[model samples]
Target: MTLLASLTLASCSTILNNLPGVYSIDIQQGNMIDQSMIDQIRPNMNKRQVLYIMGSPMLTDAFHPNRWDYLYSNQPGGEPRMQKKVSLFFDGDRVIGIQGDFKPSALPVIKESEETTVDLPPRDLEKTMWEKITNLFGIDDIDRSTESDRLTEPGPATSEPTINYPDDSMPR
Candidate 1:
């Protein structure tokens, strides 16, 4: 009876550990825009230009053709999730303003429709929503809203492509 009790106790834990619970799938919805893509945004950039740089926005209201929403959300098993929302305001065809987690750089604004990629000078870092709120209350030292924070232009184009892999012919 003593041996039987110990055996049952040992197997109980193993059984519980082996039991499979329903796995929840991580869901991702909306556009996933990165800081580099947001940095490409420039004042006076038309809707077409914005589309070219960052791809299509996830949310576009029928009533608001001038407003574009870039939303991203991710949930991984046993990990903290993240969400980001970027709103671009356009006046007629040109982009007028922007809002969300990132801000543009200080490089000269490039308007070439042909050239899509450009290097930019680094500028001030972006603040979180909490930081912005704290700033509104005059408690935080960081301030993110200013005319100097806007993005400049695309940098000079590179002569060679960034990726050059060596030849690797498969044995036929």
Candidate 2:
């Protein structure tokens, strides 16, 4: 009877997992190559330039030493998987040919987006725990100095001596 009950419970586990309300997470794997990065690649460009533009290739096979493959795939829960790839063949250190799902446009024009920088003021904070506790309890701290006095006071100076170390003159 125990064996039969165990078998019945084991069979329902699969059904429970397949229920309509069950949630599944999306999966993404390998190097993510987009159109803009792909457009930047040109024939006769060096390996260093390609590395800068495309980050790094997903797969590098020892059998084909001169080829670099960039692969990207995404599977959103129950949906079908979507894949993108680009392969570059190198002659010595320079890229010779390109292949795969994406190809560069005839006259590739890179659009630069404008960015704004904002500078924020430095944060003022109480340095010690005792000071925080005293302030919380509505009591005056030990060093009862005004804001102007605190501002005018010099910060803690380092007393440690600095030593000169040997420079790195080793060759690569």
Best by TM-score: 2
Per-model C-alpha RMSD? 30.1, 17.7
Q: How far off is residue 98 in model 2, in Å?
A: 1.2
How close is every model to the real structure, measured as TM-score? 0.47, 0.56
Which residue runs does candidate 1 get wrong by more than 4 Å? 1-26, 108-172
List candidate 2 stretches off by more than 4 Å: 1-18, 117-172
For candidate 2, the per-residue lDDT at 37 reads 83
Each prediction's Cα lDDT score?
0.81, 0.86
Candidate 2 weakest ten by summed lDDT: 163-172
Q: Which ten residues in a row have the lowest lDDT in candidate 1?
A: 147-156
Q: What lDDT is reached at residue 30 by model 2?
A: 88
Write one digit per residue (lDDT tens) for candidate 1, span 46-81.
Answer: 888899888899989899888999999887643468
